[model samples]
Target: MTTPLQPRNTAMFYFQAWISFATAMTAMGIGIAYLPVSAWVRGFIGLGALFLVTSSFTLAKVIRDRQETETMVNRVDQARLEKLLSDHDVFRPETV
Candidate 1:
C-alpha cells in the first residue's frame, strides 16, 4: 500500500490568507458600523455578524476535525490489515 502524501503549505500562503481574511472582516465591520440605522437595528445586525463569524469558525473546525479523525482511523485500519497479511504463513497453513 502506498503512503499518503503530506499536505504542503507555505508560510507565505498562510500569511496571505490571514491578511485577506482580516482585511475583509475589517471592511465589513466598518461598513456595518457606518450604516445609517437606529441603535437597535445596528445592534441586531452586529449580533448577526458576530453569530455568522462564530458559526463559520465552528463549522470549519468541525469539518477539519472530522477529516483528521477519518484519516487517523483509516491509517489505523490499513496498518492492522498490513500486519495481519504479514503475520499469516501461507505455506504452513493447514486449511485448504
Candidate 2:
C-alpha cells in the first residue's frame, strides 16, 4: 500500500540529511580556512571538501529518482482502483 507520498517523504528525509551534512561541511571548511593550521590539516580539509560535494550530489540524485518512481506507481494504482470501482454495476435492486 505504498503511496506517492511515501517517496516524497523519503526525498524530504534525504534532503534534510543533505542539509545537515552541508552544515557540518561548512563548519569544517571555516575551521580549516580561518585557523592557523598546518599543511597536513589543510590537505585533510581539502579532501573533506571534495567528499562533501560528491556526497551531496549523489544524495540529491537518489532522492529525485525515488520520488519519480513513486509518482509513477501511485498513478498506476489510482487508475487501477478507478477501473475496478467503475466495473461494478450496483444499480439494480432485486426483490428477495
Candidate 3:
C-alpha cells in the first residue's frame, strides 16, 4: 500500500518559509538604514536587528522541522511495505 501525499501540509510549510524569509529581509533592511544618533532611532535599529535575528532562527528551525517530518513519513512508508511483504511472504526460501 502507498500513502498519498499531503498537499495541504506541504503548502503550509512553504507559506511559513516564505513569510519568515521575507520578514528577515525586511528587518535587516530597516536595521541597516535607520541608524542615527537620536536614542529613538538607535532603539528602532536595535529592534530591527533583533527581529532579523529571530526570524532567521525561526526559518532555520522550520526548515529542520520539515526535513524531520519528511524523514518520518518515509520511515512510515517503509514500515508499511515491510508489513505487507511479511503478511504475504513475498520472498520465500528455497524448498527443502
Candidate 4:
C-alpha cells in the first residue's frame, strides 16, 4: 500500500475559510435576532443554529479521525506484510 500524503492549507485559504464561516454565522445570527417575531421564535431559531454548528463540528471531527485511523492501520498492515515477505525464503529446508 502507498503512504498517505499530508495535506497542506495555506494561510490565505485558512483566513478566507475562517472569514467566510464567521461572516455567515454572524449574518444568520443578526438576521435571526432582527426577525419580526417574538422572542420565543428567535430563541428557537438560535437553538437550532447552535445544534447545526455543534453537529457540523462533531461530524467533521469524526470523519477526520476515521480517515487518520484508516491510514495508520493500513501503514501498520503494510509494514507487517513487508516484514513477512522479507523474512520468507522459498526452497529453504524445513526444520524437523
Looking at model 1, the pairs that clash are: none
Please identify which of the two predictions, 1 or 2, would achieve the higher TM-score against the true structure: 1
Error in Å for residue 75 of model 3: 0.2
Using TM-score as the measure, which candidate wins? 1
lDDT of 1 at 5: 96
TM-score of 2: 0.54
For residues 1-96, could you state the per-residue lDDT of candidate 1 as single tens digits?
789898999999999999998998898889888999988888898899889989999999999999999999999999999999988978985967
Residue 85 accuracy (lDDT) in model 3: 76
Residues 1-96 of candidate 4 have per-residue lDDT tens digits of 456678899999999999999998999999999999999999999999999999999999999999989988988989999889978988799899
- Model 2 alpha-carbon miss at residue 50, Å: 1.7
Global lDDT scores for all candidate models: 0.91, 0.81, 0.78, 0.93
By TM-score, the candidates rank as 1, 4, 2, 3
Per-candidate clash tally:
0, 0, 0, 0
Candidate 4: clashing residue pairs, number: 0
Candidate 3 RMSD to the real structure: 6.4
Off by over 4 Å in 3: 1-36, 90-96
lDDT of 3 at 27: 73
lDDT of 3 by residue, 19-39 (tens): 987887787666666655787
Model with the higher TM-score, candidate 1 or 4: 1
